[model samples]
Every structure is written in structure tokens, then in C-alpha cells.
Target: MKNIRNFCIIAHIDHGKSTLADRLLHFTGTISDRELQEQTLDDMDLERERGITIKSHAIQMDYTVNGEKYVLNLIDTPGHVDFSYEVSRSIAACEGALLIVDATQGIQAQTISNLYLALEQDLEIIPILNKMDLDSAMAEEVTDQIVELIGCNPEDVIPASGKTGMGVEEILQAVIDRIPAPKGDPEAPLQAMIFDSVFNSFRGIIAYFRIKHGTIRKGDEVKFVNTGKKYHADEIGTLKLTMTPKKVLSAGDVGYIISGIKQAKEVKVGDTITLVSRPCQDVVKGFEDVKPMVFAGIYPVDTDEFEELRGSLEKLQLNDASLVYEPESSMALGFGFRCGFLGMLHMEIVQERLEREFDMTVITTVPNVGYRAMTTKGELLVVNNPSDLPDPSTLASVEEPFIKAQIITKSDFVGQVMTLCINKRGVLTNQVYLTADRVELSFEIPLGEIVFDFYDKLKTISKGYASFDYHPIGYKESKLVKLDIMLNGDQVDALSALIHRDNAYELGKRICLKLRELIPRQQFEIAIQAGIGTKIIARETVRALRKDVTAKCYGGDISRKRKLLEKQKKGKKRMRQVGNVEVPQEAFLAVLQLD
Candidate 1:
């Protein structure tokens, strides 16, 4: 136990965390040359294609130093702001963390936020300067930045290149020398904190946990303190490239346990696991529950497939505990679920994963942020959907969620970046120059403004040099309006959005135009109107597909043709009253893609 070291890697997106992890695994000989692949820790194909780590991955490695063997448990975490919950959970189960900074990019917004999370957990932080092999690497400047940020000595930061495996030996040596081993009494009651879990069709649900006290053995009856569910520890093992069965796993070790638990809700991530024979006195205080930043409805393409969709979500929730959902029915979309996600990126990844992993075709509604509405009687209501908003005539003001956003970029793009934020109704709170050429700008912005296209636009205007990170500050009263899109005088609740009053008209105009292009022509004309409180802000029409009754009488008398045309017009007017518009899936998607 004294020779065991548990640590995780945390960094900004594309800061070489996974690459560094790949090098570590290879140098430790945990994986052979034949099995080694780029971004080996990212198992999902979506992760590989996007070059991002969507989930936190845990693995164990064996090392020999000074003629003594040591066991190291390492968790590789995602870097995006949306998956910060994953980072927090990973930090909860570790004794130390490797704060990796890109040599070429210096310190980023996400890198700083993740470091704070680790600091809050009181985990020992070891700073490492990665990407040393690149020609653009600014090792000296970046090393200084790391020292100033973490308050560590210049000598404490190790310079390494994940691509060439530089300083691999030194990193491994630091883990054993600096990171303390797990502290617990083996004779104490069995206590463990499940940090992550996955679903297995053949073996049932597999939960990965870090033992906090005592030992767990195969066939032992373990009980989850949170859910109060009991299960037999059918199999226990450490996570290498694959699961290696062990008869027993004691305190300080990270391992997986399978109990043939089929129900996804039975095994909850962050729950305490203790033996039924000798349960622990206190529950494990893991990370807090995930706070979702964006809400949207996900409905099956076919109404009857609702049950199948629920099953898929349950299984998916087991894998991704950050996902929060509840059953909801819509007038236009039929039955579906309103799921809360960490951000737009997280929402997109979940939608894509459902389609690819579970073969569930779904339509996602317009994403929005949760709001607090106070009624005339002083009753506060949580509005997760625009349709849930009370009448505008209600006697109280509405409060919108706001966030403190930190953006780091070069000085050249500062003007453009500031303009973009101000246009989003963000108020500049602070500005500091970390270096002469690099600046860190802080703004208190409404969460709703950044939910849709803020991230995409920031990347564009800064030419991909800016990194943005934000956390909720609290609720602030704002003049907001619920923008509803109507089709043929009927409200399409699924396409509605609660937006700031100042920008509502511009946004409504954009949506109306975009929908006009997306919705196909019907038998009769379709009116696409965006309205707020019965006042139409914008409108567009999709002309009907005209079938000329006069086409067959081109050479006939003009009076006869006019009579026939008038008859066709009357029939078209009647058809318009009864015809129904079939909104294609692409139109719903286009609303989300509106610029």
C-alpha cells in the first residue's frame, strides 16, 4: 500500500493530455507495440474523430524504481468545459494530479478551471510542460506561466514532449516521490466510492471505484449506501488494457466490480460501496451532482419507439451520470424526454452517441437555459422550456442564469473578442495581461447567450487562438421574452425559445428565414411566423405547389381559362385550411444551426 500512487491527468482541450497518457502507458510497458494506437485512452469512435476526450478513463500501471515495485492508478480526463464534472469526479478518486500545460499555447481557461477543481479536492498537483518537441514550443515562457499560476518553483515543472516520450522517466519518478499513497485501515469496514461505470450487455453493469477503507473480495455481498441496493461482487479486478480478475482489492486501489446488475439505476456513480457484512459508518463524500447548463427535448422519430428510447437512455445514463432527463410529451413532437446537458457540445455528443451506439433515431429540440420566473403571488417557478413560461402579463420579473466567463487570447484579437462578447450582452468585469502579448479577459455574461453559437463564433473570430471557460455566478433579473414559432396559426412548442427582449426580433427574423429554406413546399401555402405575446415579430411563407388547371387549355378562350383558374383558386383556399405540414427532421436541426 505504501508503494501505491493514484493520480489523474488534467489539462485544457488539445493540450496533449491523451498523448502524454499514451506515452506513459507505452513507456511503462502496460501496452505492447502491437496494441498501441493514437489516443488509446479515448475508446469512442466519436472521440477519436473529433480529437477530444469525452469521458474520463482510468487505468493501472506497474513500475519498478530503485529495486522496489510500485502500482500507479491513472485517470485521463476530458478537457472541455462541458466535461468538467468528469474531471471533478476523477479528482475525487485520486491522491495527486498532473497539471499538463501546452508549451505552444501556455495556460488556457479550461486548464486554470480544472486546476482549481483539483486544488479544492486538496490533491497534490505536479505541473508538467508538454509539447516540447514542436518547433513553436515556448518552453521557457510557458514554464514561467505555470510557476506563476500554480505558485510552484521553476525546477518543479518538468519539460516533456508527449510525441517523443521525453522526460517519461522523470514523470514516473515524480509520481513515486511526490504523490502520497492512499491512507486507510485494512481492518476497517469496507468503503469505496464508485467514480465511474459502464454498461455491458453480456456481463451487466460494471462499476469502477476506488477503495477508501478495508478490502473487498469476490463473492462478497456489497451494498450501495445511496441506492440501498445489495449485490454480490461477482468479479473484482484492476483496469489495465483489459480487466484482470483479482481475488481481493484493498484500500487505495482503483478497480472494477461486476455483480450482474442489469438495471442502470441500481448502480449510481459517486455512490458509496460497502460490504453488507461490515458496512462503513460514514458515506463517501464524492463530488457533487452534475449541474446541467443546457436543456433540450429528445424524442424518438417514431412515437411507438418511446419505450425503447427510455431503455436506451437508462443504459446510457449508467455510462454518463452527468446526463439528467425526465419524461415529457409535446403537442408537436409527441412523447420525448427533456434532458439537461453540460453544454451545447455535450448535448451534441449525447445525441450523436445515442444514434450511433443504440440505433435510436431522435429529434432534438431547440436548446435553452433554465430560468427562474417569479409569479405575482411571489411563487418562484423553474422554467426549463419556453412553453412553460407564464403569461407576460404576470406581475413579476424573470431572472436568467448568468456565468463568469474567462477568455484567454492573444492581444491582436482582443478588440474583436471584446466586440463579440459585448454583442452577446456581456459586461466586462476585469481584464489582466498575463504577458505582454497574451491577455485574460473576464466577463459576466448571461448563460443563455453562450448556449447556442458563442463557442463556434469565438473560435472563428479569434482564428482558433482563444479559449473560453465559464461557471455560473447566479441569477440576475433580465428583460426576457419567450419567442414562439407558429406554423399555420398553430404554435410549434418544440421550436420555441426564451430569449432576451433586445435580441428577440433579430433572432426571430433569422429563425423565420432559416425555417423558410428548410421546410419543403406543401400542397398549400405555409406561414412561418415568430411571435412574442401575440405580436408577430417576423414572418415567412412557403408558397403552395400550384397545379395549373388551365395548363390543359392553353389554346382555349381567355374567359374560359379565367373561369377555370378561379375555380382552382377556390379549391386551393379550401385545401390550405385542412392541409397539414410535415416538418422534416432537417428543419428542426436547422433551427439549432441558425447563425
Candidate 2:
């Protein structure tokens, strides 16, 4: 165990985390130069296309110094705020972290946030200045920022470039010198903490865990402590560029185990694994339970695919433990699952992955934050969907969750960023000048206010120079009301949303207009109305697809044309009454993008 070191890489988005991982693998000879690629750990195509690491990847590398062999388990984590949960899980299994900051962009919001996570876990921190090869690299300024943020010595910060493999050997030496080895008793009962897992159609569920005590062999009988289900280890291996099967993995070692279990629910993240023959008396406290900040309903376009959707979600949950969902039924969207996500981006990624990976066509409802309602009867009720809210008459008050948002941007764009957050009902709590031209502003804003397009707007106004990160700060009483969208006098629950009272009229108007363009014209006119309870506040009309009845009566008697027109009008009115207007899938998605 003295030669074993477990650590993870954390940084802001686009700070060259995956790129740095590629450099480390190359320097350690874990992969050959012929096999090297950009963002080698990021295997998902979506991640490569978007230039972001959506999932945390773990790999083991062997490094030798002065003829002494050492094993390093590296977990590369995501940098986006929405995926911070992945960073936290990675931190839980490691004893140290590599805090990489882009030299051109010093100490962004996510860099600070991820640092706090590592500090909380008591992990040894190794600060490194990345992207030093760039012409615009601010080496001295960024090193100062790193020193101030982590309170480390200026000389301790390593200057490196992921593109050129600079300072690679220094980083390796630091890991061996500064990071402590994992401590455990190899002779004790077997115990492991499952940090992540993945599904395989050919075999079954494979759980990636770090052994805390004792040893696990290839064919040991294991039992997941959380589920109490037992299975024989079909395969036991270490995670390298590929799975390298081993006869036994001792304490303080990271490895994967295949139990040949088919059900996704049985293998839960943060669950402890122990041997069935000689189980550990005490379970390892894995990590905190994931809290989802955004809720939305995901329904299959084809109603018959409900079971398939559920199965796909179960498998997805095995991969992403932060995703929580429950069975729900929408009047307009048939059977679906009310999925809880960490943020809007997390929700979008899950939706896109469902389509791409599982080949499932799903319609996602408007995203909203979970609310707490205190009823007239003095009962507190949790409302995840707008339709789940109690009747207005019986409701005492609605409380929406608030978050403490941190925005770090240039001094020139400070005023613009402040105005945008203020319009979203945010109150500036504090501000500090990180440097002569850079500032960090803090605000207390309702979570729902930023659920729609706040992130996009902030990036635009700042010209992509600002970095934002936020955490929930409990709930506060607010003037909020549920806005319902009525089509032909029938409410579409899928389109309804709970919004602040002040912005209701304007947002309602915008949604109505946006829907007008998105919903295709049908044989009958569709009346799109936005209402608060029984009072309509905004309305739009999607005109019916008209067939020229007068075309057949050209050059005929005036009465013939008039009679044809009157007959057509009567048919239109009848069709409007009986026919149900179909709201296209795009309408639900477009309403989220309304300016």
C-alpha cells in the first residue's frame, strides 16, 4: 500500500483536464504514442463533439522511480457545475486531487468550487498551471490566483502544457512525494466502496470500486451491503486503457468486478461491497446522497414504449447515480417518468443520451424546480410537477428554492451581468475584486429563475468570459403562481409551469406566441391561451389549414359562392369543437428557449 496512490484531476470546463490525462498516460507509458489521441479518457462521442467531459473516467497507471515500481489510480472528473456530483464521487475514492487551472483564464468559478469539494474531503491538493504553451498564457497572474485560492506556496505550482507534455515528470514526482498512500488491513474482512458502475449487454452490470480492506479474488462470493443480494465475482480486473484481469486485488487498490447480475437496481452507487463468506462487520460510509435541483417529465412519443423507457432509464441510472426518477402520468403525455436532474444541462444530456444511446424517442416537458407548499391544513407538501400542486384555495403559500450563485467575470461586463441577474429577481449579496480587471460577484437568486436560459444569457453578455457556479441555499417565500396553457379550452398539463407572479403576464404572452409558431396548422383552428386559474392572461391563434371553397364556384352565381363559404364555416366550427389539437414535440422544447 505504500507504493499505491489514488488521486483525481479537477478543473474548470475547457481547462485541459482530459488533455492533461492523455499526457499523464503517455508519460507513464500506459499507452503507446501510436495509440495516443486527444481527450483519450473521454470515450463518449457526445463529450468529444461538445468538447466537455460529461462522465468521470478512472484508469490505473504504473510509474517507476529509481527502480521502485508504484501504482497510481487516476480518476478524471468533469468540470461543469451541472456535473459536480461526478467530481464529488471521484473525490470520495481518492486521497489527493490535481487542481489544474488554465493559464489564460485564472481561477474561474468552477475552479474555486471544485477546490472546496477537495478540501472538504481532506484530499492533498497539487496545483498545476495548465495551457502554458499558449501565446496569451498568463502564467504569473494565474499562479498568484492559485496561490491565493489554495494558500499554497508559489513555487509549489507546476507550469505545464497538456498539448506539449511539459512538467509531466514533475507532476509524477509530486504524486509520489506529496500524496500519501492508501492505508488498510489486507488481512481483514473484505470491504469496498462502489463509486461507479456501467452496464454491458454481453455480460451484466460491472461495478468499479476501491477496496478499503482485505482482498478480492477472481471468483469470490460477494454481497452488496445496500441490497443484501449476493453473487459470485465472474471477473475481477484493474481499469487501464482496457480491462486488465488480475488474480487478486488487495486493499487500497481500485478495480472492477463483474458479478453477472442483470438487474440495474441491485447494484447501487455509494453501496458497500463485502464478501459473503467473511463479510466486514462495519460498512464504509461511501458518500452523500445526490440531491436533484431540477425536475421534468420524460415521456415516450409512442405510448407502447413505456416499459422500454423505464428499462433504459434504469440502465442509465446505473451509469449516472445523480439521476433520480419516479413513475408519473401526464394527462397530455401519457405515461412517463418525472426525472430529477442536477441542472438544466444535466437534463439535456440525459435526454440526448436517451435518443442516441438507447434509440428512444421521448418528449420532455418544461423543466422546473421542486417546490414546497404549505397547505391551509398546516401540512407541508412537496410538489415536483405543476400539476401536483394542491388547489389554490387550499394552498397557504408556495416556497421556491433559492441558490447562492457565484459569477466571476471581467470588470467591464460586471454591470451587464448584474443587470441580467437582477432582472431574474436576484439580489447582489457581495462583490470582490480578484484583481485590477477581474471581479467575483455573489448573488442570492431563486433556482427557478435560472432554470430556463440564465446560463446561456450570462455567457452571451460576457462574451463567453464569465464563469458561473451555484449551490442551493434553502427555500424562501415568493409570489409564485402556476401558469396553465389551454388549447381549445382544454388544459395541457405538460405545457403548464409554476412561475413568479410579476413575470407571469410577459412570460405567458411569450410562450403563447412561441407556441403559435411551433404547433403546425391543423384542419381546425387552435386557440392557445395562457391562464392563471380561470382568468386568461394571454392568447394566440393558430389558424386552421384552409381549403379554398370559393375556387369551385369561380364565375358562378354570387349565392353559390356565399352558400359554399357558409357551409365551410359550419364545418370548421364543428371540427374545432370535437378535434383535439396535437401539440408538436418542438413546442415544449421551444418554450424553454423563448427570449
Candidate 3:
């Protein structure tokens, strides 16, 4: 145990955490030169293409220094705010973290947030300033900021360039010396924390865990503390890029246990695992299920594929415990699933993965935040969809979820960013100048206000120099109403949304206009109206394509042409009264894109 070091790399997005992990893998000779790939730990193609880590990966490596063999377990974590919960769980399973910060970009919102998460776990943090090879690298300034903000020793800061492998050896040596070895009693009753899990077709659910107090071996009967389901460990292995079977995993070690549990829902992340025969008297602390922050409806473009979509989500959810979904039906879109996500990025990734990995084409409705509704009977309910909201007469008050957002940007664009935030109904809580040219601003904003396009606008206003991170601050009272879109007097629940009452009219008008532009003209005129409850707030008309009814009567008398036109007009009026508007799928997507 003295020679074993368990740690993870934490950083802001695009801060070279993956590159650093790759460098360590190469320097330690854990992977052959011929097999070495850039960002080897990032398994997903989407992650590599986007130059970001979406999933947390764990790998075990062996390094020999001064004739002393050491076992190093490195967990590489995602840096986006959307994956903060995953990061926290990864950190909890480690003893130390390498806090990587870009020398040029310095500290970002996610950087600070992740640093605090590491601190909260009481883990050793080694401040590493990466990208020293770049000409614009401000190593000295970034080092000072780390020391001041993180309160770490100035001399202990390590400067390295991931691209050039500079200081790679020194960083590895620091890990052996600085990060403490995991301490656990191997003789104690078995207790392990399942930090992550993956499903396999042949092997069933493989649970990735950190043994906190005891040893686990093949054929051992283990019980999940939360679910109370018992299973015999079919196999035991260590993750060395790929799974390597092992007979036993001692205490203070990180590894995987494969139980023949066919169902993925049986094994959950952040659940405690113990030997069923010799169960631990108490389970490990700090295990909490991830709660989704954003909600949206996912439906198949072809209604017949609903079952296929359901199966795909189930398989995806097996790997991603953070994903939450339940069956839902739409008046216009038919049967679908109402899904919950950590954030917008997570939602997008899930949709993309469903399409690419599962070969499923799905339509995602407008995302929404969970709302608290109080019925006239004094019952409080959480509504995930606008259509789920009760009638206004049956509701007493409503509250919307809010977040405390922290933004870091260049001081030159502070005014522009502030204006954008204010326009989104963000309330400024604090502002601080990090440097002469860099600033950090905090705001308490409604989650609904920023879930759509606030981040994109913030980037545009700041010229892509701004970074933002947020956490839920709970729900607050707001005058919010459900705005429904009606097509030719028929309500379309798929296009319903909850908005602040004050901006309902303008938003309704904008949505109606966007729908008007997207919905195709039919044989009969279509009336697109936005309403709050039974009252219409905004309306737009998509006129039917004009057909020359008098075209057949060439050189005819004016009275004959008039009679033909009048008959055509009467037929059009009757068609408009009974004909149903066919709203294309693109129209629903267009409404979501509306600003």
C-alpha cells in the first residue's frame, strides 16, 4: 500500500488534462509506442473530435523509480460543468488530484469549481501549470494565481508542457512523493464504493469500484447496500486500458468486479458493495444519486420506432446512470420518453449517442427546468413538463429552479456580458477583478433563462473568451405560466413551454412567427396561435397556396370568372373549417431554436 498511489486529473475544459494523461501513459511505458494515440484515455470518438473529455476513465499503471516499484491508478475526468457530479464521484475514489490549468488562459470557472470539489474531498492537490512550450504561456502569473487562490506552496507548483512531454518525469516523481498512499484495512469486512459501472453482452454488469476497507475475490457473494441485491462475483479484474482478470483485489485498490447481474439498473454508481456473508456493519459515506437538472422529451421521428428508442435509452442508461427517462405521450408527436439530463451538453451528447451508437433518429423537444407547482388543495408538486402543470385555478403559486452562475471573462467585454446576463433576468450577486484584464462575475439567474442559448450568446458577446459554470441554488417564486401553441385551434402539447408571465406575449409572438416561417402552406389556411391557458397571447397565419380557379376560363366573361372565383372561395372557407393542419417535424425543432 505504501507504494500505491491513487489519483485523478482535474481541469477546465480544453485545458490539456487528457494530453497530460497521455503523456503520463507514454512516460511510464504503460502503453507501447506503436499503440500510443493522442488522448488515448478518451474512448469516445465524439470526445476526441471535440477535444474534450466527456466520460471519466480509470487506468492502472506501474512505474519504477529508484529501484522502488509503485502502482499508480489514474482516473481522468471530464472538465465540463455538466459533468461536475461525475468529477466529484471520481475525486471521491482517489487520494490526490493534479489540478491542471492552461498557462495562457489561466484559471476558468470550471477550474475554480473543480478545485473546490477536490478540496471538499480533502484530497492532496498538486497545482500543475501546463502548456509551457507555448510562446504565450504565462507560467509565472498563473503560478502566483494558483498559490493565492488555492493556497498551495509557491515552490511546489509544477510547470509542464503536455505537448512536448516536458517535465513529464518530474510530474510522475511528484505523484509518488506528494500524493499519499491509500490506507485501508485488508482484514476488515468487505466494503467497496461503486464509482462507475459498464454493461457487457457476455459478462453482464461490470462494476468499477474502489475498495475502502476490505478485499474482494472471484466467487465472493457481494451485496449492494442500497438495493440489497446479492450476486456472486463472476470475475475480478483491473483496468489497464483494457480489463485484465485478477483472482483477488486487496484493500485500498481500484478495480472491477463482474457479477452475473443481467440488469444494469441493479448496479448503481455511488452505491456501497459488501460481502453478503460477512457484511460490513456500516457502509461508506458520501454516496448520493445524481439528480438531473434539465428535462426534455425525446421521441422517434417515426412513431413505429418508439419501442426501439425505448430499448436504446435503456441500454444507454445502463452506462450512464445520470440519465433519467420515463414514458410519455404527446398529442402531436405520439408516444415518447420524457428524459432528464445534467445540462444542455449532456442532453445533446445523449441524443447524438442514441443516433450514432444505437442507430436511432430521435426528435428532442424544447428543454425545461423542473418547476414547483402548488395546487389549490395546497399540494406541492414538481412538474418536469409544461403540459404536466395543473390548471391556473387549481394552482396557488409556482416556483422555478434557479442557479448561481459564475462567469470568467476578459474585462474588456464585461459590459457586454453583463448586459446579456441582465437581459436573461440574471441578478448580479458579486463581481471581482481576477487580474487587470480578467474578471469573475457571479449571478443568480433562473435556470430557464439560461438553459436555451445563454451560453452561446455569452460566448458571442465575449468573443469566445468567457467561461461559465453554475450550480442549482434551489427554486424561487416566479410569475411563470405555461404557453401552449395551437395549430388551427388544436393544442400541440409538444410545443408547450413555461415562461415568465411578463415576457409571455413577446416570446409567444416570436414562437408564432418562427412556426409560421417553418410550417408549410397547405390547401387550407392555418392559424398558428400562442396562448396562456384559454387566452390567446399571439397569433400568426400561414396562408394557403393560391390556385388560379379562373385559369380554366380563358377569354371568358368577367361574370363567369367572378362566379368561378366565388365558388372557389366558398370551397376554401369550408376546407379551412374542417381541414387539419399538418405540422412538419422541422417546425417543432425551429421553435426550440427561437431566441
User: Of the candidates shown, which would achieve the greatest lDDT relative to the real structure?
Assistant: 2
Candidate 3, 504-555: lDDT as tens digits: 9999999999988988898878899999989998999998888988878889
Name model 1 segments beyond 4 Å from true: 551-563
Root-mean-square deviation per candidate: 1.5, 1.7, 1.7
- Give per-residue CA lDDT, model 1, range 449-525, as digits (tens): 99989999999999999999999999999999999999999999998999889889998999999989989998788
Instruction: Indicate whether candidate 1 or candidate 3 has the larger TM-score.
Output: 1
* Residue 103's lDDT in candidate 3: 96
Range of the 10 consecutive residues with the lowest summed lDDT in candidate 3: 282-291
TM-score per prediction, in order, is: 0.97, 0.97, 0.97
| Model 2, span 1-595: residue lDDT tens | 8999999999999999999999999999999999898899999999999999999999999999999999999999999999999999999999999999999989999999999999999999999999999999999998998898889999999999999999999999999999999989999999999999999999899999999999999899999999999999989999999999999999999999998999998998889999999999998887899889999999999999999999999999999999999999998999999999999999999999999999999999999999999999999999999998888899899999999999999999999999999999999999999999999999999999999899999999999999999999999999889999999899999999999999999999999999899888999888999999888999999998999989866686899999998999999999888888888888888888786
